[model samples]
Structures are given as C-alpha cells and as structure tokens.
Target: MEHNLLQAFTTRKHTVLTSSKIDPTGATSTGSLKVKDNISTQGSQEKLGKSGEEEKNLKSNKKLEMRAKDTGSFNIKMNPLNKDSLDKPDENGREEKSTESSKKMQTKKSETGEGHDNSSFEAHQETQGAKGHHGNQTTTAKIQQTTAFISKQDNKRQANQTQIGRSGSNVMLDVRRRDCSKTKCQYVIWQCHHQCMGWGDRLRGIISVYAFAILTGREYRISHTFPCNLKEFFHGNKTLWDEKVITAEHATKRNIKLFGFLPTFGSWVLQSSNLSETFPEDIITFRTNNDIIPYLRFNKNFTKTIEKAFSMPIDDFHYVTLFRRLFHELFSPNKQFEEKFQKYYQLLKPSNDSTLVCAQIRLQFIKVSGMKNVFKFLQETIKRVGKSKLLVSTDAENVRSAAKTLFPEQLVDIEGPLGHVDKPGSGCRDMEKALTDFLMLSKCDILIHSPSGFGQQAAMLKYPYKDVYQINYAGVITNLTIPIFKLENLYEELGPLGGEQPPSLPSRYIKNPQKYFT
Candidate 1:
C-alpha cells in the first residue's frame, strides 16, 4: 500500500510539472495554480527521497531568482495560497494580483480582453504611455499657438498707440460727419483766384476759413480753380473739399467774398460777434492773404467755442498745434505728389544719426543783401550743428547754383526748375515740385530761411519745432519763437484789443444790405 501511494504521488507530480509552463520571469502561465504547483512539486520530491532531483530543483530556483533580478522583474518568495492571492481590483479599477501571479494574470486578462495573445500587457502599457506622450505634445502645440497670437496682437496695439501719440492734437480734430446737404448746409469756402498770392497765402486762407467754419458750425470747402485745380497737388484727408459739389448757380447767388487787411471789410468780418447773423448767406467765401488764426485766438468766445467743440483745453490749442492740426485734417499728399515727395525724401537718406538743415532762399522776395546774410546764417548753423547736410530749396535757380558751389559735398537739392504755384505760367509739374519742396523743408532738423510765408508755413508744420532762424529783409537772423501760435503774436499787427476796427454792421441788422451782400 505504501509503494502504491508513492507511485501515485510521483505520477501526480509529473502530470503537474508537464502541464505548468514557466515564463521568462519564472511565473507560471496559469495564475491560479502557480503557488500551488510549486508547493506540491516540492512535497512530492521530498517524499520520494530523491536527493539529486532535490538538488536540481534548488539549482533551477536559484537560476530563476538571478534572472528576475537581472531583468528587473518582481521575484516571488514562497508563500501559502490564499483568497487574496487571486486577482483583485486596484484603486484604478484595473486587475492586480500577488507578485507570484501578477504577470501571469495580467497576460491572461490581456488575451481574454483584446483577442491578441502575442501582445502582452506590457506592450499595452507601452502603447498607453505613448498615447500620454502624444497628448502632452498636443497640449504643448496649443500653448505655443496661443502665445504667438497674443504677441502679434500686442505688436499691432503698440503700432496704433505710436501713431496716436505721434499725431498729437491733430488726432482730436472732429472727423464725424456734419450731416447736411448742399443747399441746407452753411458753407465757408476758401475761394482762390488769379491773384498775386502764393501757396503759403492760400494755405493761410484755407486754414482760417476752416477754423471759421469750425467755430461757426459750417462745412468748409476749397474753390481753387484759377491756375490749376487744388486737387492736382493735395486731396482731402477726412473732409473732402471738392469744388464740384458747389454748383455755379449756388456760388453766384449765395457766395459772399470777404477780403482781409483792406479798409472796406478790414478785419471786422472775422471779428464779428455773431458771424452767423453777420453773414446769413448760404456760402461765405474768403479771399485773403492775412492769417486770421491770431484773430480767432484773440476772440475768447471763439476760442471757448472751439475748445468745447474739440473737447480740448484752450491752452492746449497753441498756434503751431492748431495750424498743424488744421493742415493735416484738411490735406494729405495725393498719390502723384506723395511719389515725388518720397523720391526726394529717399534721396536725403535720413536716419537717426544724420542731421539735415533746410535753407529756404526766396530770391523773388529776399534782396541780395538778405540773401548774403541768409547764406552766412546757414553756414554758421551748419557749423554749430556739426556734420550736417544742407538741403537748399529756392524759387530762383541762381540760389541753388550758389548753394551747390558753396557746399559741394554737404549740399542736397532736387534738380528742377522752381516755379510759383500762384503764377499763371506754372504747370502741374512745377506745382508738384513746389509742394515737394515744402514737404521736404518740414522734414529738416534745423531751418534757416528768408522772411517768406512759404518758409513760415513750413516751419509751422514741422513737429517738435527745432532750431528756426529767420533772415529779415535787412539780413538779420532772428530766432523765431516756436509754437508760433501766441495771443501776443496774433495781436501784434492788430491792436492790443485784438482788432483795429469794429464790425460795420450791428449784431442784429433790421434790413439786408442787398447792394453790398451776395
């Protein structure tokens, strides 16, 4: 009976050993029987009293332990089988088991779930890790896109801010439409004729009329078609001053021309207490060379109204500031003028380090002695500024030749016949050249010019009004005060009280003076 029992036990052990399979980590393929098979095989070997077989089993167990350590696999110590040794759910709701059964159970779970027996749980874990990495990569790409968009918006905002800051008070000029029709709208048209006036005088009249329109709540337009169309050189920026909008019939019936500095109208038309009442006509046209900005500035009521209209303080409306704002608000260089202007500006090759001194020598107006003094003043200015380029703009060809002869290396001037804008002989190209010269003078750092309205207007348009020295008829260089807009300067030619004469008509006229009126 004992021999029979020993043989049966040996047969059972042999069957268990043949049925079990060991993985590379030494865990059995059948998870449920892994610990059980190891214990049963050891017990059967001891019972048979086979010392060599026992030694062989010990050697194999040692080899598995070494292999587990080398492969960084979890080594299972011999332990009794229990209910907890079976696969149980972990915190993540995934199946987990004891060290001895973990690999085998995970393998079986993967085979059952995915129908891929060759693909182990470790391979699935690697795929999940790769997926997590890709997810992180996707998140990183979105973050970079968001950052780039924000940076682009920031740069755009900065550019807009720079433009606004550079424009100064000009940005505050009312661009909103007045919403009025041709007949119904009260208009202040700057009428230009074939008179003895230049571009500077025309600009002054336009600025004055525009300011008058602003103060009295009227639409401003330009009717300059004598020598050439005003649209040839300049175009309207925010407000279009197209003369075609005004009909010939309307101009004939409703237009009232007011000339400044004359005995009849004098300055009373501009100084009238009630312009709307004084001139009840639909269109009030101005044909004057006198700058009425100072007169407008002297009128406290007018200044207050302008300040209120523009929503700016009275003090902030300096002479230069107001002139610049009016000039830019009314006109922008047309494409043709702009192209020529850019061509000359590029010729200068202006940069932060380069200093350009503009010298305007009007031979038509300035005498020979004055011209000499002007050149002397320019030489002194160039010497003072140090390493300067002299840009010469003049109405006479002789002045250009003289400047080139004087400063061959440092002189810069456009090669063109200088022509007056108001002259009948001047063509479109001449007008374009004149406008280009005016704009280029404004770009210079320092201005040494003769006593000419052209030079004065250019200086007024200059931003940050740098060193400006004007040479009078006697050839004396006077340092003109900047922001040329001052109450005293406005009242200089006019009396201390702001005007020489009062309005000819009363504030309220009982009868319309039809003979004198439009």
Candidate 2:
C-alpha cells in the first residue's frame, strides 16, 4: 500500500509539473488539448505553495513582480507608523534619528492602536542614555525643561492669538467709537498716526502761526499804535503801510496809545463858549485804526478828519448814522467854534518863517485889542529884515491892501473866489479848492493861509524849506498847559523870525508841540 501511494503521489506531482511552451509553470494553458486533460483541473497544493513563494520573492524584488501584492501591499499602508520604517536610513544614509522624529512615529503608531504599550522602563532607559551622553544630570534636566518650556510657550502663544483676535470685538462696540461722542483725540488719532509725519506736523505749526499772526494784526515784525493808518504807515519809516500784515494785538495797543492822547484834543474843544459839555474823548477813546481813512484824495472836513484818524473799518452808511447821533458832541456851534479857532491861532503861532506869515494872516480874525501891539511888532519886523517876500492869503480885499501897505514891494496876493457855497459851514469849500490849486502852483518861499480847513490842511502838508510855520486853533491844542502869550513872548525872544527885540515863547511850544490847526 505504501509503494502504491508513493507511486501515485509521484505521478500526480509529475502530471502537475508539466511545462507549457509559453509559461513554464503551466499556468497559461486554456484549451482542451492543454494540461487540463492530462491532470486534475484544480491547482495542486505544491503549485499553490510555489505561487505564494514566487509572490514573496516578487515582493522582495519588485522588478520581477507581475501580480499585485496581497500581504506586503497592506504593509505599505502601515509602514508610516512602523518603527522599522522609522529606523531605516535617511536620504543621506545616516543611521541616526532625532527624538522628535521617533516620537512622531510613536505617536502615529498610537493613533493606529498598534503597539502603543510603551514601557516606563523604556522611557527611563532613554533618560539614562541621554544623561550618560551629556555626562551631567542637570544638563539633561535643563534640556528636558527647555523643551517643555518651549512647548508651553507655544501653547500660550496660540491662546494669546485667539484672545487677540477676539479683543477687537469689545473695541468695536465701545461708545468711544461713535462719531457723536468721539473725543478730540479719537477724531484725529487715525489720521495723525498714519497720514501725518514730520512734514505734516510742521505744516500744522505753520498754519497755527499764521492764524495767530492774523489775530494779532501786527506787522510781521514791527509795531505801532492802533488807529494806525497801515496804508499810510511806512513799514520801517511810517509810510506805505497797505501791503503790510497786522494783528489784533498791534491794533489794540495802537488804539490805546492813540486814544490816550485824545483827551488832550477833547479838553481843548471843551474850552469854548458855544460848545456843549459833550466831549470828544468818548468817541476818540473808542476809535480804532480801522476807522481811520489813511489816504484822502479829496478834501475833507473837520468831522471827516476826526473820522479818518481812527483805524476801525467803517462803512459810509454807518458813519452817517453815527454822525447824526453824535453831531452835537463832536462839533461846536459857530460862535464857540470861532472862539476856539482864535485860541488855536494864539497857541500854535509858527516858530519859523512860513509859519509866521501864516500866523499873521490868521490874526486877521482876532479882535483889534491886540492889533496895536501886533502892528508895532510887524513894523519892527520889517525894519530888522529890511526886505522880504510877502505872500498874503485872505478873502478880504481890505486886509490884503493893508498888508500890501506894510510891505509894499514884497506883497504878493493869492486871489481866488471865496465863500461861494451858500450853505452854512460850507465857507471852507471854496477856500479848499483855491488852496489846493495854490499848493500845486505857487513857488513862493513863504506861504499864508486863511483861517479855514483848507488853510490848516495845506499847512500840514510836508514842504521843503528851512522853516515850517502855522497858526493853530484852540480846539486843536488839547495838551497845552502854558499861556499862549507867554509862548509867543518866548518865541519872539528867540528871534526865530526877523524881529528886533527878543521874542517870547514857552518851552512846551518848542520842545513839545501840539497838533496845529489854523
């Protein structure tokens, strides 16, 4: 029986081992004439075993493999978590693996639930090995501590990032962000922080400086009193002031200084018979540079002159309104006006030639009470001077003739139409027109003027000569403290004119002169 069994097995093996022309393993035959008729159809255990061995060999040498792998194919998926895979050499063929890389593999293996029972002994061995390599327990501990510290720091950083992202939520809802309730800083901080730099800050400072400059109303670098005719006030020399910049401070200071001097003018006007108790101080004190008209192209009256003396901006309609209300306070009645006019004459008699001639003509309106004395003074003046050119300004022909008799050869009369205006207080109109022409035309070394606005205005003009003289009216001499006769006496003693005996005058008239009006 054993012989028979051995023979059968050998026959079966032989039959199964038949080789095909195309495939030596006899796996490719398909038709009835193939090995199927020669042996049992089912593949034998020996052939199956041989196929599995071939597949294993194929798995080891991928080049020879034709069939897809079964057991090894599944291992490909698990290879990433395999410790053997991690133990494999790196791209550079280095045998070493970092702890981080090893831990990563272990962690991956843990996720797969495949051999995660890591022993405390293994961990202790790793610690002992690390300590042995470092040769100091503290050093190994410090490395571990540093690693843990870094890990904690990383976690904290992540948490902080989360908090920071949410921090603005409250900020956005803050009431401070509302435009209606915004603080001054909040309104501009964004622009200031991002848009404004050094240049922008400098520009802001410059704008502020300019705004402040405008408020002060001062010349960029110079100063002067208020009611200042910036147009007439020279930048450096008190002329040509229009182009200059000014500030309110400049205007205020100037106004105060100017108004302080107004009382002097006001007091003079107060000393007249027809004058009321009304004082000019009330107006002059309030006047500012803006109210003053610096340049008068046409003739101006007393009211106009006073109006132009202030620096305040004034509209014509407003001026008329103010004038109507303050007329009595500003002007004197004719009788008192004439009296004050006489006082100005005595107070502001010229100290020199042109003024002397002007003053003599001015005395024509005075009473003859001082006439004999004046006549004697004139006779002596002629004898001492011998010969002099006489320019007489007068509306009266009789007065002109009398002056001619006194200086017959030297007399030159300016003849013009006088008092043509029928209106009250308009007598000065014709006189002003005539004087304007005379000033432009006459080349006389000396000049005389009638007791009128035109005469005073003409006298105030800047003339080129050795002497400037004028007869001032009382209403204009506000600061005078001394007697006019005493000043006249002293001036006569000084012999400023061509008089024989010493003329009399006061020190105040010489050193400090009041504004002159004829």
Candidate 3:
C-alpha cells in the first residue's frame, strides 16, 4: 500500500545497513541500496491486487511459501507473529504463521545448500561510500580532529616545562608563552624622550615609562635608543621595536640638558608629547609627577593611584611583585649569557649552608678610605661566618685584584662587564658579561652591592631582596629595606622567548595569558 526506503551509511560505529522484502504472493521487487547522499528515498509498491490470480495458480499444490524475489516492483510482507509486523494475530494464527515462515525459510536454505553467512564479511564498498550519518561524524574524521587538538596542548605543556628548566639558574627566567595572538590595540611606546644621560639614568627613565604604561591599561613595548638594541639582546621581534619612535623627543631632552640641571625635574608626566603618535587615546589626562617619585617608594598615594588605575588592590607596597613580574615576562639574557652564567655559577656555588658572600662593589663608588672600609668589612664578615666563601664582582680590574690580595684564602672576583657602553656589537658582549656577573651574585647566599645602577639591578633581581647588603660611602654594608617576593611571581612568566616562537599578536593578548597557558 505504501513505500519505504532504507539507506546504507556511516555513523559513530560506521555500521553497514541492509533491507529485505518478502513476496507474500510472489510479487516483483527491484531497487538498490546506497550510501551517503548517493541514493533517493522514494520507492515503489504494487501489491495485493493480483493476489487472487497468483493464489489460484498455486491452489492445485495447496501450499504457501515465503521467499525473496525480484520483479518490476517491491512487495514486502510480514506475519502477525513477527515482531516488526503491524498486525496482531490471535494466538492460534500466530502459531500457524510461525510454523509456515520457518518451513519456508528452511526449504529456501536447503535449495541453496547453505545458510546465510552474516559474519563472513565486512560491509561492502556500497556502505563505505558515505562520509557521515545522522547525528554522527565518521570515525576517521573524529580521530583526525582529536589528534590535532592534543598536539596543540602538548606544545604548550612542553613550553611550560622549558620555563621550569630556568629555576636551576639564579635569575627567575620563567618563559611562559603568553598567548598574545588576539588582535591588540596599538601599543604605547615607552622611552625617556632623552638620550644624553648615561645608560644608568636612561634605564631608570625607561623603568618609569613602563610603570606609566602599566597604570594606563594599554599594551606597551620599549623603544631602545641606546647603541645596544634591547630587542636584539632580549631576542624580541622587530615588529615590536616601535620604528616610529620620535627622534625629536631625544633631541629635546639633549637641548634642555645644555641649559641647566633641572631638565629632569618635571619630566615624569603623561603629556601629549610623550604619547606616541601610534597610540594617543590611551591616557585621558596629561599630568606631571606631583613630586618626582623615587624609584623605591611605593608611597601610599602613588600606590592608591596605581591601584585605582588598574581598578584592583595592590597588596605589596614595595611593588617588587609588579616589577619582577614585568621583568620576568619582558627581559631575559640570551643563550650566550645563559651558558656563561651556568659556567660561573657552578664554579662559585657553595657546597654547604656556609655563608657565601657576593660583594658587588662599583669601582666608581670605591675611594681610598672606602677601600679600607671594604677590606675591613670583608675580613670581619669572613671571621663572623665560618667556612664562608667570598665572591667579588666589580667594574674595575683593580678592585678585583685588590680583593684577591686582601683575602688570599677566598675566591676573589670576575671583572664586571667591560665599561658600560650600550651598543649591540661590542656593547652586547659587555652586557653579556654583566649578565653573567649578575647571576653569580644572585646565586650567592649573601648579596652586597653599592648604589650603582648595574649593581642595584642585580640586587633587585634576587628574591628576598630585603637581605641584600648595600655598601655606603663610609664602607658600611647593611641590608636596606628588605624586598620580598609577591604572590604574582608564582604565575607570571616572561611571555614567549626566543626567535622561533609564533610572533605575538595583539588579539591573543588575553586579559590573563597565564590562566590559560598554565
């Protein structure tokens, strides 16, 4: 009375499908099954009208048979006793139908000399045609998709592992791959609109600029004007170097310096001039520092201003937490420095808990009287801490030789980075040496340094910084304000490192790259 169509297709299990029809009165059947979208579902059914004529032809035998046959049209039938059948027959009729169906099936098998072998073969080529089924994707596709996903996850895990490898060294060089792949707004350029000062003063000014960037809620990158290209030393990307850094800015700083000492007086303000043409809308108001804020003062009002700018509570007053996080995620010594540092560290690392003193005396700061004071302090310090080892890192070779002569029994020193010039070729070599020396001092149990920028930077790099010994002009060595590590250190990382990483994109600079990368 009606037509039904079945298809062969793939599913989660990728099973093959087949359909069967019975000729109740020897009717014709003709159709083919297909997979995927290859076949249509409209089928033919012409039955029952010729049943009387067919029955009359077989009445002489007084028997009925159920078998599959092919004619111009399909004629499918089912007995009441069959579970799939629509009719429900009485108990007697059901028994009779079962007996007749079984006898007919046996007769067909005997005629063929074998039973149907359902498990003898896999699904034919007909079934393999379809790529997918309703609500189920093909197994092959699913496997390929899963494999791609796992590969990405594995890459990230390996990156994090590489980051952990740096823990053996003194510098906290955790290299978490920051996912800055998202589209980013233009980043503000942070540089001291000046270049006439020494590398030390320039570095401090750069730090101040960075702090401003952090407070303003805009992405920031440095514009290194010194001879040593910071981007090259740190292995940063060329795209991030701010090629458009205003040269006029530097000229202005130099011009003002010629006239007086007050050029640096009110320079720490967010002005239209300081705002890079690339990112002008980042700060709403242009204002100067209320009082030229010192480097170490995370003073109450300044602290509040930063907290409000970021709209969060800053629990650590020293801001060491913030500064270290920034340093770890931004600056890293290159391969040469790393290998050199490891070599020196192994050579100097103490065998036991015996107090190892690392003295970072700047040649510029050490005078005749101060030199005597330093000698006295070293002797007194050695006597006070038994089995103590001494390591001195200084800018001048004379200081290195003097320390060695004074304490012939202890390890003396390595000459600090060859006079501090800031160019890439020879200057970079000097930078590398300084980096190694910084690592040497950081690894020692007791750190001693003077007010020199190079020495100060080394002291600040070490955690529990509060224990660092700062030597005054009087040659007195004592720990200044003890700097402690912040909770942020546990998760912050030095974005992606090395040249081979996927270049950072502004879009992927997620609000918190660590949460996802970790």
Candidate 4:
C-alpha cells in the first residue's frame, strides 16, 4: 500500500512511521499492518493503552526521510516499493547491482543539482506536489544515503525485506548523510532452539540460555511458538515479556547456536575455551537442558572462576539461588495454571508431622531403561512415609491408572497426565500435565523423582526445609539434603545434618561424564 508521508512532509510535521516498531522488552518486532484495537493505521499521534489484542499484518509502506543539514540544504531519502532494485543478475552480479544502485542515487542527486541552493529545491517543491510551504524550505544536503531490499522470493507474493536483527528493528528505511555515517551496531540474541517437545524440557533449555545471557549481561527475548500459551499472563507488562510479539521468520534468522547434551565437565571446558574473555558469537542457541550445571555452580572456586573469566563481580552467585531467580523471571504462574494448581495442591490435609510428599515417577524413561518397578517403588514410598498424601506425576497412561488403583483414596494427582491443557509430553507422556504436575509437586514437602532435569529443577526450586529423593534405576532411594546430590554422591545419600558443602552435578547422568556429551 502507498502512504502520503511525502505529501504530509510539506505540512512541517514528523509523521508517525509504523514501518518499524521496537518492542519495549528489547525483542525484535515485525513491521506489519496489525489491528491494535482502535489504534489508527494512519500516522496519528494519539497513543493507545496496551490492553487490546492486535493483528500483525505487515504493510509494504514507504518511508520518507528528510534530514536538515548544516549547509542549509535538506537531504531526502525515500525507500522505494521495488525491493529487487538492488538484486544481482547472478551471485557475481552483486557488485554490479550495488554500483548501479549507487549510480542511480548519484544521478538523482545530480538532477537535484551540485549546488547547495535551497531556493532551487523550494522552486521544485510544489512541482513534486509538496504544497502549503510558506517560504524557501530552510535545509541543506551534503550527502544522501538510501538502503533498498534485494529479496530472493518470487515477485508475485510481495516478498519481505531482510531484517536487521536488532531488538525492535521494524523500521523499513534509515536516512543519513555522508557526515552522518555511523558505526555498524551489533545486537546480541540468545535463542533456545530446542524443539517444543516437552514443557519441563523446554523450560530447562530456555533457563540455560537465560543463565548464559545473565552471565554476559544481555537481554533475553521470548518467542510466540514456545510450548506454553503464556500470552495472557505476560500481557500485563510485568517481567521481561513487556515488549511485542516475535514472528517465526525473524526468530529463524536470529538463531545463532544449538546446544545438545554435553556433560558437566565438557560444558565447563567449552565455556573456558569459547567464553574465556567474552562470547565471540553474535547469537547462541542450545538444545534442551544441555550440561550447564558446571557453569552454574555455587562453590567459592567456581564463583571466582566465573567472575575472573567474565571479568564480572559475581562472588556471591549461588547455583540454586540463581536458578530460582531466573525461574521467577521467566515463568510467573498464570491465573489458569495457578487456579488448577491451588485446587489440587490443597486437596489433602497434611499429617501431624505436616509432611506432604509428591512422587514424580518417570515411568516411561525408567521402564524404557528396563526398570519395570513403578508399583514396587510406590509401595516402598508408602511403606516408609505412611499417612503422607501421594501426588504422582508420570507419563505412562497405565502408570496413572495403576496409581489410582493402588492408592484409591490416598493417591491424588493434578488431574493426572491427560488433564493438562498445554500437553507438553510426547509418545507415552502427557505434555499439558507438565505445568500442573510441576506446580503441584513444588507445593509438596518432599519429592521422590527420577534422576532427570525435570525433577532436579523442581527439587532446586523447593524451599530450604523441603526435601527431595532421587530414585535411581536400581531403585535406590537417596534423599537430597540442603546442598543437593553432587555428581559423585548421586549413588550415595548424604547424612541428615552434614557440614556446609558447595553445589555440584548429580551422579545420575554424569557417570562417565563425557558419555552424555554430544
């Protein structure tokens, strides 16, 4: 569509340019003609409240830039609708096309005249349909600059322009003169490229990236296609989600790294090597829950090492405490999720000891590992911790049914695997149950879980007095006390009130340590 911005130019006003919009949260936003309630598409100066939903439909709008120069001549730069104006005839055609575009710009400038005559521009202003000018337009132009898109898409469908990956980069064209030449500004983007498979796994992936950003002092941006439907919850402009929605196209171009499984030591080694001074890459992405524990340790040595490496003051950074803070920043409970959690979390009364236990039996993976002992483990938990309400969260359908059968009245779940709305799991698992399960599990006084990041996360999020148990493949139930189960002590349980020790990786997957490396 065409805009009368140039026509409005002579009116002596800065028009509202919607060609680009910067997200307030520092995330990149698409320049689309989206209906934002009653907000006008025209460049109206009226500001609107942030309470309504808007449709994001991009427009091929033209941007007109008029810059007042010190020489008393105005430099005008207009972005044309034809993006292919800069396309090369071949891969080798790039230089030629660039030269041609430059020549055309020079030709336009020459046509405008080599002399810095403001009266000549004024004489031609009305000829170009710029009316209502009082006198000679007081402006000067020493240099002219224009940026055009060279699209690779077919010409019929209205191909989009190449996006500059800066946060809130939606402006179509930039205007400047020779003296106004600026430095190339670079923006840092950290994305979690893990497939939106499971909710807990997705959380682990993003939380890892967030930790990375925090360590490097960068803004972490969120996307739309993430596992959970968190739009309404974060729409209130709280936390780091206060900006605009990110499109799939823009996110694809900004993905810099993809992290898979890397054991704790391997991760540490990579960090020391790749990030000794600073992150060399422009963007960093990772797989779901890669080996990050080593980088996020709570020990004095680890703290000093990280601080020395990043040259930042983080002498007091604790692994669990930092995790807690990041979790709070990323995932505030939505009203819907919170309502469901509170309903079942407070269902059963606590015992005289006020001890409530929720066991997250990862039946699918453990059974896949050839451990066919879900029922036996539940029975053992009941036997050892009597009268404690059993809130089970498992993936297998059969496991949920069996728990209901075994504990009948005593067993309660957050409506079980199928009851969740998000449905974060795959194969024999229920995905939606992840949020409900995690929320309810966090409320329990004790957690008996399989040795996975999901349980590890919940356990770390639990309060100080709360306890956690890691049920290994061998059915050895080990309680995780204050400092948590280190990589060396995963097979062994710590004593009730031991001395203060620093944090380390749990022994569950870090056996060979390098075995889990990608």
Show the lowest summed lDDT stretch of 10 residues, model 4: 51-60
Taking the tens digit of each residue's C-alpha lDDT, what string does model 3 give over 227-318? 45565445442123333322221121100111001111111121112223312332111111111122212223355665555333443322
Model 1 segments beyond 4 Å from truth? Answer: 1-171, 181-183, 243-253, 258-260, 263-273, 294-303, 310-321, 380-387, 483-490, 493-518
- Displacement of residue 232 (Cα, Å) in model 3 is 5.0
TM-score of 3: 0.46
RMSD after Cα superposition, model 3 = 40.2
Between candidates 1 and 4, the one scoring higher on lDDT is 1
Ranked by lDDT from best down, the candidates are: 1, 4, 3, 2
Q: What is the C-alpha RMSD of each candidate to the true structure, in Å?
A: 46.3, 60.4, 40.2, 29.3
Which structure is stronger by lDDT: 3 or 4?
A: 4
- Per-residue lDDT of 65-166 in model 4, one digit per residue for the tens? 111122222222112332111111233321122322322221111221122211111111101101121222221111111122111211121112111111
Candidate 3: Cα lDDT at 117: 16
For each candidate, what is the lDDT? 0.47, 0.23, 0.35, 0.36
Clashing pairs in 1: 319-485
lDDT minimum window of 10 residues, candidate 3 = 142-151
Best by the TM-score measure: 1
> TM per model?
0.58, 0.23, 0.46, 0.47
Q: For residues 359-431, could you state the per-residue lDDT of candidate 1 as single tens digits? A: 8876543434344345444555555556667788887655665566666677877866675665567666666
